[model samples]
Target: MTYTEAAEYILNIPKFTTKNKPEHTRAFLSFLGEPQERVKVLHAAGTNGKGSVCAYLHAMLLAQGKTAGLFTSPHLVKINERIVINRDQISDDAFLDIFEFVLGKVKEMEAEGLPHPTFFEFLFGMAVTAFASAGVEYAVLETGLGGRLDATNSVQHPLVTAITSIGLDHTAILGDTLAAIAFEKAGIIKPGVPVFYADTTEESNRVIEQRAAELGTPCKKIGKDAYEILGIRDKHIAFSCVNAYYGNTTWSLNNIGIYQPGNAVLALEIMRFVFGEEGRPDLWREALHELKWEGRMEEVLKDVYVDGAHNVSAVEGFLRSLPEKEANIILFSAVNDKDYEEMIACLCRNVDTDFYIITRIEDKRAAHTKELQHIFETYTDKPVFVRESLEEAIDFALEHQHGRKIYCLGSLYLAGMMKGYCNSGEQ
Candidate 1:
């Protein structure tokens, strides 16, 4: 089958079957020869910044001259973006080869009356299998959802685990309160494996500490105090860690997001654990200075950027990272499952935007453009425009910029569509 057809088959699996139990995932991995066991895996989980943390780890591993694989979620552009080795996405031929093999396994399972893997599970299996075949020395795995029962959690052993900032997301499945959500994220902690986490809140930190204690694992918390932002200049944000080993040296990231320093520091601490005295902070510094994570305040066009900040907490971070009191134009869209109203309210209250444009993402769960427009109209006196088509919304935002920057945000799907449009040279 063609690569497109193979991807379609995996995407359609979600429509027919629900997520299987953890045992099912473990058993499937076993059937696939437990490829995860062949590599030193670094598992990362949290509400936000987990993907960034994984990217940082992968970059650090590469800087150290180790072959690394990165498995992330909600690819901003293509399915190949979800799996990368040595900074390159898996080739279409490689993807189809693995897809056909996994498809055969799924058929065998069906013949034995076993449930087929869900969309995420099938992809996770493919990532590990590909990593194993390539003989990568390390693999960075990001949890798809809440960590405890996530398909990625089937990897019973990992060299280390890290948890990024925790917040109220996936409230129905994970939990509503911060502590409840923290418990789910902390489930990634395994006995004797050291875990590092971003110290987001007192309540959440307490839950993670308790979980680590119960598992008899060493847990280190990296708080905001661990690093201080120096400044943002020339499309880069510079920060200095409090760790004296760095000797007050400032580290800069290619992207200007304010929250990235925290994510970078979390990855730095994990690398310290893994590499000890042999860890080359200089190499890591250079790697981060050159790294650019797509869809996180990524500038797709001149002064036109897209961010994947669909949840309330991520929106808060996005607001914090924006230039204070600068008038901007926001092109926003979100899925129905998100708290888009609260996200809108937060953006309207905090940001000095010239106006707001609302559009719908290309997803079955996308919120209607009219609904988003009404919500924006309620929150701010700023002119709210509705465009049923994302392309029209982009055009309107650009024409109405009036020298103000344009930020398209609210959903990864929206970011993906915008990036695809920009890359297609249609913008």
Candidate 2:
């Protein structure tokens, strides 16, 4: 099948919601000759900062003259962006080659009476094969959802396992409470593995601590063991890494956000563990200078910023990271069934900018404009109205907006659509 056809075929399959076991992935890998064991994996799992932490770790790995493989989900612009190696996407030729190989193996599985691999399972297998084929030294993986039974968890060994701040997201699948969610994320930890965690609520920390104890893993949590602060004007952030293999040094951050201190320290801590003391410091400086995490607190254009903050924790981070002031924002959103109303309320309360709500073109779960308007009304009767299309929404914001700082908030699909408007080939 062609690339587009392959993507559509993957999407058409019915989703398998339960985290039954890792056997599905294992079976598929066996069929493909077990390509997963060839690379060193750095696995990251959490609610808010998975993308940023993965980006940072991948960048640092590349700077150390190693071929790094990055696997993320729900692409902001192009499907190829989800699977990158050495800061470049897996090309059409490479994508097609491995997919066909995996599909053939999948058909063999079905013939042998095994269950069909789910969409995420297929993606995970493809990622493992691609990384092996490219001979990458390190594969930086971000879990698609919760961790306990995530398709990517078949890798019981990783150089380092990081758990970003746990928060209430994917509540139905993960659990209702932060502690429950932390337990799911902690699934990536194994015996003797060094765990790097960022700032988590006290309740969440208890759950993580329990899991680490059960696994017999030594953990270094960001805010608890190491910490950072934003420099003058927040153009830079600094962190002291006492727990890190790097010497006790205060790092100056290139990503501008007060909320970044947690993820920032987590990334540094991973580098310190991955490399020895000297390599950690050098890689840290190089990666921070070249860090580019799109859709999650990213500056896409000269004056416009975009963030895919689809849940309460991410929304809170977006608001906390930015200057507290009212500005015009081009907002487009699409969330899972569980988070729509709460996400709307969080956006309206903390992000008090002029919002232009746009409708998503393709995704089925997108909320209608009238429904969004009603939610906005519940927060305030202010005229942060809706637009029919993404172009119209951007046009509305551009026409009414007065200053250099432009912002876009809400879902990854929204960020992808607006990224279409920016019209750049890069993600």
Candidate 3:
């Protein structure tokens, strides 16, 4: 099948609540000779920072001169971003080949009255196949949803499982409380496997600790107390970590947000567990110095910044990363499922935003521009403007920026769209 046709087939499939069976993923792997079995996995799951943690781990592994694969979700620009090996996205031709192979197998299964794998499952299968074929030393996986039934969780035993800060995200499927969501995220902890998690609330820590105890798994956590940020100067954050395993090590990150110290500590702890003596301080320095993860406090243009802070906790992180000076204009959009009201409240609490430009992104789940404006207006006296088109909202923000910063946030979809808009040559 052509790559475009293959993308249409996978992209059109329902993302959640489909005929995707957890066992069917395993069965499909069995049919394909279980590529996952050949690769050592570092599985990560949580409400936020999962992607950032995975990105850090993948970069560090590569810096350590290891062949690594990364499989993340909800692609910003293209579907190929979800799969990578040796720091390169799977080529379109390779994606087509893998998709056609999986589609052929899926057809065979359908002919035998077997259910089809969901879109995420298919892409995950492709990642496993590609990683194994390429002989990657490690594959860092970010869970697509709640970890208990997430397709990536189908890996029987990852080398090390890490859970980022747990919060009230995916409430409908995961649960409404922090403990319940922690329970789902802690599902990645296999028996006797060492698990590392970012420090969160007391309730969340309790839930994760209880799960680890039941499985006899060793659990380590990185919290604010574990790391101290020296300063953030010119988009670079200098920090000192006082973790038990890694000791008191000072490091600096290039253009990373204020909240990244915790994620960095988590990645370092996981690396300590996985690579041990092989973890070189030199490689760690190089990785941190050049590490980059898009859609998180990213300065895409000269003074315009974009962040994917869709939920309450993530918005708080995004806010912490911003300059104390207020933004001249803020362009915001988010999915309907997010707590944008709280997110906007956090933004207002942190930044003296002058104007709020509410926009709707290209997603069926996007919150309407009018609804966002209503919520944002209730939080701040900033004049709220509505533009259903993302490009127009960006234009409005840029045109009125007046030498002050223009910040776009609230959703990764919105951030991705704005990143494309700000970087377009025509702009």
Candidate 4:
């Protein structure tokens, strides 16, 4: 199949299926000769910050002169962004070739009465296959959903596993309570594998600790005390770490959010655990200072910022990490499944936005603009605008921007759609 046809095939399949079994992935991988088994994996899972943590790990690994692969989910733009080797996305030619090969394997499985893989599972398989073909030494995997039943967990072994800050997300499937969500995220911790996690809420910490102890796994909790913050300003952070492997050496990341320092620490701890203290501090400094993971805290225009803060915790971080300057307007959208009520409340209560524009995004899961505006009304009495089109939303936000900042947030789908518009010079 051609690239377009392959994409159509994958996208046509249900985004998520009720059956989240790993057996389908196992069977499919076996048919493809078990490519994931060939590479050393670094499995990461969490409700938020998994993508940034994986991006940091990929950057640091490459800086150490090692071949690394990155597999992330819900691409902001193209599907190729989800699969990368040596910092480059899979090319159209390579994607088409892999799709054709994997299709053959799928047919073989279907003939044997095996079930088909979901959209996430198929993409993850392609990433594993591509990584194996490239002979990457390490593959940094970001779990699509909860860790326990995630397709990425099909990988038998990883050099080390990390569970970043866990919060209440995917409450319908993963569970509603923080402890229940933490239990799901902790599923990546394997027997005897060294696990590292962010020192987050007490509920999450207890769940993760208990899971690790049950498996006799050596677990380390990287808390605030493990790192000393030197400065936080201008959407950048500088910190020094006193963790077990890392000395109290100072490091800084430019053009990133305040919440990123913790994620960076998690990635650094993983690198230290796997490759030892041989990594030069200079390479790390250069790499992190220039690290770019789109749609997190990306500035699409001169004074406008866009973020994908769809959930409550992420929205809280976005609001907390904002510069002290007041924002002129906030354009937002979120899928129906998310807790947009709490997200809206957080943004309204924290940041003083003169205008709030609720817009529709390019996703079936998106909450309607009217519905979102109604929810926002309950929290804030600010002037709220509704626009069905993203371009119109941008226009409205800019028209109301009186020299203050225009912040677009709420959903990654919205962020991606806005990024595309901005790149096309349509802003």
Candidate 5:
């Protein structure tokens, strides 16, 4: 099969439950020789920031001259972006070659009456197989959804497991409260394994700590055991590490947001914990600045900041990163299942921001601009322009932005789409 054909085949995979029975991923991986066991893994699970954390970890490892494999989900532009080696997306030849090889085995399994794997499970199997065959020294796997039953959890002997901040996301699967969500995030913690806990909510932290105690894993909090961001200036962030293997060293993070310090510190701690003194601080510093985490508080164009702050907690972090009450306009859109009201409401209360609500295309989950317009009327009498697509949204915001900054938020999918548009247009 060609890469395009292989991609089409995988897209037909059905998403299944977040349950404990790993029958699907197990069967798929077993057919592929369980290659996930071949490399050192830094498995990460959380409601938000998993992708960002994975990118940071991959970058750090690559800087140390280690060949790292990165597996993320729901690509913004290209499907191959979901599986990367040393910061580069998988190539056409490799993708097609693996897909054809895997396809034959999948057919054989089905011929023998084995249950077919879901889209995510099949991809997981393919990625691990590819990484193993490619001789990846390390693999950073991001959870597709909730942790415990996530297909990526099938790996054993993870070098370190880290949880980004826990919050109310995937409530139907992860549960209602912060504690319930934390339980799902905590599912990644295995007995005797070291876990990195970022600066999360106190409530979520308690739940995680309880789980760690039960599992007999040492859960080290980033701010307490490791270090965190001491301060931030325009385009520069200062970070320090204490319990980290890199020791008490501080450096500049080229990323724009202060929230990244948590992920940065967590990455350093995980790297040090996994590699100890062999861990290089210089590599960590170089990678932190050079890391390209798309749609996570990224500035894709001139004076325009894009973030996939789909959930309430993410929105809060994004808002916290912005300057105080500097009047501006927020160009936003969201998927239907997200807490758009709470997210937009939080932004409204926090910033002197106006709204230019846009409707994302193609995805059935997208919320309509009319719905957002109605919600905005209840919150503020500020001007709200409606657009059908991201291009129209960008143009509208730029036309009226004048000296004000443009913030595109609410959905990561939309951010990806806008990024592609900007990239193609040379913006």
Candidate 6:
């Protein structure tokens, strides 16, 4: 099948099947020759920052002269962005080849009366197959949702597992409390595998610690106290780790997210655990300096940025990264499942934006522009404008920026839409 046809088919799979059991996924992997077993894996899961952690680890592996593959979710522009090797996306031809191979296996499974893989499961299988086929030494896998039953969690063994900050995301599926959510994330901890996590809250920490203890696994927690942010310099956030191995030297990231330093340190600890003495802090430092995870405080244009801060906690982080004195203009959109009211209240009360522009993502889950506008109106006296079309919102934000920084946030889908629109050269 052609690339377009394959993508269409995969996207429509969700209509036919929901998430399968981890055992089902494992059996499917076995049917596909157990490609995940051929490569060492680093699995990461959390409410936020897991993708950033996975990206950092993949970059470090490449910097150390190791062949690596990175698999992430919620592609910004293209499905190809979800799979990468040696820092480049799987070529369209390679994606097509892998798609056809996996489709053949799915047909065989169906013929035998086995269920077909879900959308994420199919993509996960293709990613492992691609990585093994290309002979990658390491593969960094990011969970699409909660860790306990995520499709990526089907990988039974990983060299190391890391969980970023746990928060109240996907509360419908993963519990509502921090401790409850932590339990779901801690499910990725395997027997005897050393697990690293960002110690965000006391409740979450206790849950993770207990889970690790139950499995007789080694666990280390990295907290906010582990790193200190110096300042933002030249559009980069600079910080220093408290770890003695990192010394008193300050490290800088290419992006301007204050939360990134925490994510970076979590990846650093995982790398140290996996590579031991072979891992060079200096090389890893250099790799982090050049690392930039898209859709997280990414400056897409001259003074316009797109951030994936859909939840209340992520919006709080996005707020902490903004400039204290500069005038700002925010273009916001969110899906219906998110706590957009709280997110709007947090942003409205925290940042002194000149005004707010509300838009709707081109998805069925998107919150209506009028609904978002009403939320913004209820929170602050700031002028709120609504544009149902994302393209129109972009035009309005840009036209009225007036030398102020423009931030597009609230959803990954919004970030992806903005990036795709900007990349289309219509801006």
For candidate 4, write residues 1-427 as lDDT tens digits.
5799998898876844446488777877999999999999999999889999999999988998999999998898789999999979999999999888887888888799887778888899899999999999999999999999899988888888999998888899999999999999999999999999999999999999999999999999989777777887566688888854455566887655778888988888888788776866568767887887789878888778888888999988887777674667899999999988889888888887787998998888889889889988988889999999998989987876768788889899988998889878887
Tens-digit per-residue lDDT, 1-427, candidate 1: 8999988898788889987999999988877889999999999999999999999999999999899999999897789999998889999999999999888888787888889999999999999999999999999999999999999999989999999999988898999999999999998899999999999999999999999999899999999899999999999999999997777678999887889999999999999889988988999999999999999999999999888998999999898889884548899999998888999999999999888888888999999888898899898999998998988999898887777899989999999999899999997
Sorted on lDDT, best first, the list reads: 1, 6, 4, 3, 5, 2
Q: CA lDDT, every prediction?
A: 0.92, 0.76, 0.85, 0.87, 0.80, 0.91
Candidate 2 per-residue C-alpha lDDT over 248-285 given as tens digits, one digit per residue, 9 for 90 to 100: 56566565655676777688778767776457466667
Candidate 6, residue 149: CA error in Å?
0.7
Worst lDDT run of 10 residues, candidate 6, spans: 319-328
Against the true structure, candidate 5 reaches a TM-score of 0.94
Score every model by TM-score.
Answer: 0.99, 0.91, 0.96, 0.96, 0.94, 0.98
Candidate 1 weakest ten by summed lDDT? 319-328
Clashing pairs in 3: none
Q: What TM-score quantifies how close candidate 4 is to the native fold?
A: 0.96
Q: What would the per-residue lDDT of candidate 5 be over residues 1-427, giving only the tens digit for each residue? A: 5677889888866553223366666777788887888989899998877888888889888888899999998788888988898867899899888787777878888898777777787788778888999999899999998888889888867988999988887787789899999998888898889899876778999988999999899988876445566776766678676643455667667666757777777777787777776878777787787666788767787788888888998888887788675438788888888878987788777788765565665578889889987787777777777888777777777887777788888887888888888889844
Find the 10 residues in a row with the least total lDDT in model 5. Answer: 12-21
Clashing pairs in 5: none
Error of 5 at 423 (Å): 1.5
| Per-residue C-alpha lDDT of model 3 across residues 1-427, encoded as one tens digit per residue | 6888888888887743375667888887876678998988999999999999999999999988999999998888889999999879999999998887777887787788777788888899889998998999889999999898888988997999999998777788889999999999999899999999988999999999999999999998777787788998768898887755455666888765788888888998888877787778667878887877888888888788888877788877877777774677888889989877788888776788778888889999998888888888787887999988977877777788778888888899987787667667657
